[model samples]
Target chain A: MSGVFTEEQEELRRYARQWLDENAPLEAVRKIAETPEGFDAAQWSELGSLGWLGIAVGEAYGGSGFGFMELAVLAEEMGRTLYPSPFLSTVVLGTWLVERLGTDDQKAEILPAVVRGDHRLAVAAGRAAVHDLVARRQGTDWVVSGRARFVLDGHTAHTLIVEAAADDGTRLFLVDGDAGGLERNPLSVMDLTRPQAEVTATDVVASPLGDGRAGDAVDHALDRAVAALAMEQVGGAQACLDMSVEYAKVRHQFGRPIGSFQAIKHMCADMLVGVESARSAAYHLASVIDHDPEEAAIAAPVAKSFCSEAYEKAAGDTIQIHGGIGFTWEHDAHLYLKRAKSSALLFGDPRYHRAVLASRLGIE
Target chain B: MQVVVCVKQIPDPSGTYTLDPETHFLVRPDEQVLDDTDRYGVEMGLQIAQAHGGSVTLVSMGPKGSMQGIRQALAMGADRAVVVDDADLKGSDALTTAQVLAAAIQRTGFDLVITGTESTDGYSGVVPQMLAELLDVPALTYATEVEARDGKVTINRQTSAGYDVVEASLPAVVSVTAGVVEPRYPTFKGIMDAKKKEVEELTASDLGVDTSLRQRVTAVEPAPEREAGVKIEDDGEAHLKVVELLQQKKVI
Candidate 1:
């Protein structure tokens, strides 16, 4: 009951597909991606109002109180359409932590407002890819000072969950994005769909996460985040397959449709295989997150590895199948390719995750 | 303000179908899904019920696999669902479907009945009218927009010449097109809570109806394939050859 999604989940996926088809079409995505804030504010607030922001959140805090699979279904739809938003950064990382690790007071203060779209949040796992931030114990107070790069949605997020190395161990600190001496500079990215920023915290005092179990909490959060990102990859990969298949059907070359060619047909078939495999892997991770976190140590990385590579290959093949028209800037082919590349590098790429999987299996 | 939305179970055509040329019967894998065309009607029903503090009930008729379509609607916050399944009901025509549906609606009282203009599979566009006749109510077809006030419902029905506004008394049947209203995604909480929602199952006999095939499909054949076309090698004479072929085929 907890892990498997019922018929309701199917309806939810259909609803999301329709919503994104109407509200977040490719043109809307293109227009929104050009902005620094990233994503349409109206859609963001609309999602919050629709209770999407709280899909996995508990009912007591204005959430739908569902498991991770519901959220994965939605993220897949959004990724399929390339809906540009900071959903993962704010919802999975910030809102989830506030629920999982924040104090009762903090949960009462933050989760409700986040669910209502009154606040935007971003989380930084120090040195995830690039980290220079340092936490120093000045008397009894903790100050975070240094630069954290590749902070997802950091440019517009009003709240921050900054991880830093303290005197004892690495800990998480909640800091206001607009705090004195905190500077957020947006980064130039190949994928404008998901914006990243370089954050500089200069002697900023902040509150420690509840009970200072930051290590365990951060580990759990990262595992879930990896799995969530894999779901997004599956969505993007499936979209590429759809675009390629549609193109192959109508695109004519020699004497008939290019789909009649054996080479093109095999490419499309290979894409189908990739898309199906990745979907299975990502959903398996969702189940692990819900019912078996212990299995996630192995499942999350395996999913991320398989799905990220599949998405990249699928997007690459989409461009290849579209030929000259796909190479142009005027086409949507390149945009999805860029997103596939960007997401592949995020959290950890296929190589890194494969290493994690192999190490966990004691193969090395 | 009780509303009943008719949903049809369609076998996803993407699945492989087993062809039986002997009996002209095609056995399709039972990956039954709610007809995409009916989603708008269901959304409208749920929306109206939410605004009016009433209940939305879904009705479907198919094989036992029709439960999949029923559960899909129930998951979308429908108060309840009723599925009528009978082997004898197989191959029943649109009017026969109306008889079965009207009987189910009688047990589950409703002020309004809704359906898609046509099922995705059949596309006959006559079930709603047949149901209206069976229930003795106004039949509003091809509604692109709908609104209710007092005891009357107004529909902006689509026609070849733009749209026509039609108002009918309460307890009328409406067949809406695909894009009437944006459907809502079922929330996770709603999906979980759907377990508690009642899905009453009945049969043609229980509805006091004789289920027998009225219309018979005699044959099933794939469409004829097109002939291969001429191919011109991409040299200097390719343009002249293309023009000659086009002239020969009378394409231009």
Candidate 2:
């Protein structure tokens, strides 16, 4: 039970792998990516019914009542299949924010609906300390006005959680997705599997989430999100390694399988090294996030940085190992490459996370 | 509607296998998992138990460490398990295994019994029949689909060409084929609760069953390496060459 992965976790992994293989194969991912919503509503509801959307949320909110480790397992499998969904935006970020920082009333209003797949939520926040949105208190309500870009799943979300600067400090507010004077424009992104949108709000009515400034809460939520993303990156890296090794064994060259060549063999070994190491880092961060938040604070940035670079390396090496066919649009290698690149930049890039790690460790 | 499913813990099939030269038995690795073939039986048993108003009990015979595999089935919603793990039961053949399982199943008391046609490791394909003989129950083998109602079990038994509908009275042995039903994965709650589920461990002596082997391996040999195959280029006369080769092999 105390092992790196418990028996239950391994069983969950097997289950998730089989379900994703059957339901969200790469071909299905391609089809969903071409749609305006970028995900199937029926599948989203199915995920909710399967107790996946609330894998990390507590049971009182009608979730599965599991912890971050279970969520990491589900995220890894979703990443392995390149599952096209709003899970990262809604379940990972929006649900975590509400569960962690929401008032009792807010939790009652939002978390159950989220677990039931009745509402989809998106988070709109700047990458840095400078706020792109500003909030003004008006009687009992608040008015938020700003333009936030790179909002994940913002276009089709039922609600939007925006981080805006109040007169006191940075605060988080919930705004209706279809509120007046709010415009959501879908942005053409390199990673078609995951869509992004630019959200511009002009005097949109909003409800304040929780009480007091949300600067620390926002940072904490972002750290957890990035750590979860690292788990996804690890899954993607392992998938690339699997593809490379499987292809190398069958594709022939010089009257023998190319896997016989030392060059190809060494590349495959290197990919294995990257994948295993990234997996350890990601799992470690997820464990710490659940058991020890103090340790998770430091583990988060380290995992995010290492896993991002490892995924990128594996994806690049996968294409190189596959040779010319990998360069074509028809091949799945490019899809992984694009995902690796986009995911590395999503949250914070390797460089940004490394800086955070260094500063956290008090390195001058 | 008490259901008892016979399961086996075998070495993970994906791992490399070795044969002990002295004993002619497979050298099972430390990493053993539930036999893939048995999953269908467990699924079928669970289904019958759920549809009726009873619980499923898994009965298995393997090494002491076989709890890992048994726990897997328990996590898939089996009520409890009875595992026969004794050092004296090593190298159990098909009939011996059936005798041990029949003892355990009798101890648990079943209204219905289910098993896979064969285990992936052994492939003897005779344990269920032997078990049925020992239990004094009707045997139904190679069932593609099974349903139970009114104290009788009905199965769609797969045959050479199509299938046959077979019905049997209560307390029957049913061997389900692979893909009989899609086994449900353990929900998170089920996985967590499996730790507390009852797993009654018994030795051969505990069940008062005889473990003497009726069959043994005389010798062991590696399978011969495959020879290179000849390729015929598809030319205008390729059909004539194919016909000549078939005639030479006496297949035409």
Top candidate, metric lDDT:
2
* DockQ, candidate no. 2: 0.39
Listed per model, the TM-scores of chain A against the true chain A are: 0.96, 0.97
Alpha-carbon shift of residue A168 in model 1 (angstroms)? 5.2
Scoring only the second chain, what is candidate 1's TM-score?
Answer: 0.85
On DockQ, the leading prediction is 2
* Tens-place lDDT digits, model 2, residues A236-301: 998999999999999999999999999999999999998999988898998888678778889988
**Model 2: per-residue lDDT, tens digit, B1-252?**
999999989988877888888878888765578898888899999888888889999999988473667877888889999989887788888888898999999989999999999999998999999999999999998999999979999999998657999999998999999999988666677777898999888899998988887678998777799989878999788999999998887777
- The per-model DockQ list reads 0.37, 0.39
What's the residue-level lDDT of A204 in candidate 2?
96
* Residue pair clashes in candidate 1: none
Error of 1 at A29 (Å): 3.1
Candidate 2 has a TM-score of: 0.86
